[model samples]
Target: MFVGHGLGAFALVAFLATVAGCSRERAIQLGIVAGLFAFVPDVDIVYAPIGLLARSVQTVSPDVFWGTANTVHRGATHSIVIGAILAAAVAAWNIPARVSRIAAVGGFLSIIAIGAVVDGLVNAGVLVVYVATGLAIGEWARRKRSSTGWLFGAALIGLVSHPFGDLFTGGPADFLYPFDIVLVTSRIALHPDPTVHLLAVFLLELGTIWLAIVAYTRLQRISIRRLLRPRAVAGSGYAAAVFVIPTPTIHTAPLFVFSILALAIVGVGIPAHPFARHRRSETLVTGLAAVTVGAIAYAAAYGTLG
Candidate 1:
């Protein structure tokens, strides 16, 4: 879902921009801006390594490891309130008025102070990273000569749309944050069976990535389907893992993910003509196709066998 966050945002913004009469180049640029900011909320993941390092015993299951890593992942940074404040800060900072700039800085600092009081010094440090990210993006947008409103809209769309993606994978995000409200109380269940549910979520993620790829290829006037190589069929072999590995659920998918992704090697394996000019794109497209094929094969096998 990490990659999905940026790609999904990119697809949505880019497609809409195209429909709304923006030129291809300009639309791609706006999509890229939104995609970059979309990654900002996940900065809380920086705390994961710290959490892991502080542990007395490092040996842990996938569930425990990720549980520890995501301790602060869906908190303040995922909040729409925090996102709005950050977007406003970016907009205010872009204003030419001295008073507006001063207010932006002051408002940002005050938010940091509030975070410190509420979440403590360590989490306050995370807030600093978050605010710094928003400000840096603001500076980049300013350098690009984007209007404040456009930048604000990009930032808001990226930040606001992010937490919603989490509802399908993990605990619901603290969408309101700094407040105790719980808008979504549980992960959305796609199916009654755990395995089927995981497969549904996995397919959804793949669909999102495919959407981004389609949008990008369309913008660039490239044919994504034409880039594939026969090597992609190799990915279907991953279906065998259904019989060998333990059944994977959302909480225990490390093995399934690692094994399936390993099939990507088939794509980049020695080509008939290694030095072909289009080899890179061919291999990349094949790799993605392989993964897609592997997932579908696994899902099919799972359904048939059970």
Candidate 2:
């Protein structure tokens, strides 16, 4: 899922948290943490070299290490046990403060932990061990005297939304990772083939960018600068991530249509919702736009190279 989607959810949580026990600063902090930590499960991709090495080790000794590490969304890294450890450590290290420092730290930790575990579950569903571990930690976190419920809510939103977003692309999420049952999208037609793949990706990516613009425009009407900062940061990050990756080929007609719709949405819809605290619609639109553009550019480049 695009970080904007996650951030949009986090923004909702943060907004609600502000109405609850958390101060504005704390709520924003939680959103920041949630947005950043939501990317945790993806870290496995960064450690691909380790996964390759582990695959070799598994071939040598399958009984001991179990070859899960070689798979992107498997093992202890995505386990609840690791989540709990992270939550506990964060809570313990929290500096003493009157405003429930432990709660803040613990909340952020749990969100990160759970997000990682659930990411695997969304993909292959075989990640039961990880989910169980995460749930146990969640139970423990829930029992705390100083609980930041909003963080958990944000995490849940992040976990669930990711898989749903991937559905648009029809990519398999490995929802049943550690489990015997695995679920991939039954609807294969939506999945990007090399031919129209770039077109679809361009639509999604451009949509996200448009949504961010909408979000910013909406925030500007209310004159809340802080509310727009995360969107900017997320937008910049998305741009950076896309820039580093190769571009895909996109269909000109679809791209043109998507761009027009995006402009319309940003220009007309956002200004109408000046006081809206959450910009989910905008976020989703922008995310879709970005992915669409990205897929197209990537496909085109690959096609040319091949």
Best TM-score among the predictions, by candidate number: 1
Per-residue lDDT for 1-306 in model 2, tens only?
355455554555555666776755566655544444444444444344455565664454433232343454433333334444444444443334645556645544554555455554333332233333434444444454335444455444444444444444434555543343555544334445544554454455455544444443443354333333223222222333233444433322343334333432321234556335566544444444444443454445545554
Candidate 1: worst 10 consecutive residues by lDDT?
56-65
CA shift of 265, model 2, Å: 24
lDDT of each: 0.84, 0.44
For residues 1-306, could you state the per-residue lDDT of candidate 1 as single tens digits? 888899888898888779878889877877877888889999988887778778848676556567776777888889899888888888899998999899899868866876788788887888899999889988887887777776777788889999998888888998998888889999999898988988888888888888888898889898987887888998998899899999999877878878887877776877786437768766767887899899999999999999
| Position 37, candidate 2: lDDT | 40
Q: What is the C-alpha RMSD of each candidate to the true structure, in Å?
A: 2.2, 12.3
Off by over 4 Å in 2: 1-5, 11-27, 52-70, 74-147, 168-170, 185-195, 209-306
Stretches of model 1 off by over 4 angstroms after superposition: 57-64, 272-278
